[model samples]
Target: MMSKEDKIYLELEDREFPFSYTDHDRKIVRAIVFDEEKKFYFVRIHRDDSFGKATLIETSGGGVEKGEDLETAIQRELKEELGAEVEILQEIGIVSDYYNHVHRHNINHYFLCKVRSFGEKNLMPYEIRDFHMESLKLSYEEAIREYEKCSNTKLGRLIAQREVPVLEEVKKMLLIN
Candidate 1:
């Protein structure tokens, strides 16, 4: 059980699928980013890996580096992954889930942000070859449909369980739904 006090909560949220991981802990960040036009950005990835090419769409951001604050890590991740400069307007709390297949646990912090500007994306090496990604700005209805499409696959189900609620929460907060 996670409360507001613990910096690193060693627990998991009740999930649709039981989540567990080999690694004890990791911290990550993601942003629900909106541009001036009101469309949100989601990364559509074609993952070429041992399992073959699998398509997935996910909100952007990544692991928090040691010694980095949450705000800085998120900013850096957005710049790298989305080529985006953003002003984070609000914190959307956290989500905890396990990747049983990989034996890893993720403590995902989410935020709601407004895009300030666009720059060139700086994806990491593997992100280029293994996960060739394209950022797509979609309307809320389109995002919901994409989530449903993603949930049809095994891995996609897990991602949807972890991320869709964050999207839903933000949608409600913004009164767009």
Candidate 2:
């Protein structure tokens, strides 16, 4: 279980925390876009508000605009973040919790997305300083190893378990021999 301090840190890191208690609550969406070649995973490098430093985060998503469905939010975020369109494969999971001193509540929707092609990456002014599609392929074990290096946050754990249908689907899509 996460301590109150840890939960607060996470909410601040995600920028979901409001300055005042009366601020309107909002939903945020993010995508995990992977290429079939297994060469690169799209990610953003940004300064975490809570951690006070820049870090590479393996997610592409943003706030859910008013009256928008989750899928629409995901698509809009992908285009806004990466300048690329994608076909969402499935909803991997959801993480919901409260961050004391930060957000009253937060629910992050995770999705596995397939990109048609790698295009120019466009970073949103706030969430990203720069972005890239790097060549890093990992087996299930390797993925877990990498995830272990980071704090055991929900996102980290999810990335550790990313070897499931996502990897399998990628292998099938690329026809890796």
Candidate 3:
């Protein structure tokens, strides 16, 4: 049997880029993994010369590694970054955007996930500075309000638009509101 890593690599290697851009389009993915406790996990990335200052962003799971599939990439990313095992429940959606003159092709796959366990979040030394696990007790309205002051990241816009309804659903699931 092929190893999980091998299977993931094969899937990514076989994928072809149907669309092209003048500038190289880098493929990326993100996850919206949540637990039964209604807490959402996010990463606080430290900015450097290439990026900027420290900023809070949604827990993203992606990178078009040679021979990796979308699902495999996400699963790998979740485990790598959060040090947690997650079971993908459903794919929420996808989004693509361009920023800073670079065309970023992000096949953002939002998944309803359950964290089986937690350990020390293993962040890439240069990519992340810290992380936080927040509860959904904060109202959607409150979340939207806080996002506005958060550097106006794409994740913020998603929350403002109520694109990922899992946050709301989780609150309801736990009877928080």
Candidate 4:
């Protein structure tokens, strides 16, 4: 199995800090997805359920099902969330973090992909009803700004803290400011 320890970087005290942590329990795939016109796909999740906190903006992705390869899992996730077909450009990096909402450690595989086409979304019912998930296309800078805005609240900060490093990795690879 591919290990993510070599690729992990963490933040502490509001600064980028290099760190390494990995365990073999869960696999989630996150896409740093771009459209043909160069806009990135992002998900805005408005979680109003009993379990969730702030309305969150996040990159497009989901849990990888058992027996599915990473590539296939990403493809399925993109389609489900954004209703888009994507040509994966590269495996950007893996980010390790823990989600307080779920109280589980995450091993997230991040991929760079270009959207090939779009159609109707196929979101899970609770995701639609409770999370109120919505899809949006954003310029790289706009996406970063969304993160900044979400960081205002406590729960939002928890998610942003985990995602910002992955977003930074994407910016570094694409030279997006």
Instruction: Please provide, for model 3 over 1-177, each residue's C-alpha lDDT reduced to its tens digit, 9 standing for 90 to 100.
Output: 122322111111112222345355657766666667555665444343333333444554657688888778887887777777888765544444433323343344445566777776566654543333222323345544445565364434433333234345444544665
Off by over 4 Å in 3: 1-22, 128-145, 152-177
Tens digits of per-residue lDDT for model 1, 11-117: 44434344453666779998999977679998988875543346788999899999999999999999999999999997777888777655677889888899999
Query: Which of 1 and 3 is the better model by TM-score?
Result: 1
Model 2 poorest 10 in a row by lDDT: 5-14
Q: In order, what lDDT does every prediction score?
A: 0.81, 0.53, 0.50, 0.76
Instruction: Report RMSD (Å) for each prediction in the order shown.
Output: 3.5, 8.3, 9.3, 5.1
User: Candidate 4: global Cα-lDDT?
Assistant: 0.76
Whichever of 1 and 4 has more TM-score, that candidate is: 1
Clashing pairs in 3: 8-68, 9-67, 12-68, 13-67
Worst 10 residues of 3 by lDDT: 6-15
Residue 92 shift from truth in candidate 2, angstroms: 2.4
Most accurate candidate by lDDT? 1
Best by TM-score: 1
Tell me model 2's lDDT, rounded to 2 decimals: 0.53
- Cα RMSD, model 4: 5.1
Where does candidate 2 clash, by residue pair? Answer: none
Stretches > 4 Å off in candidate 1: 1-21, 50-53
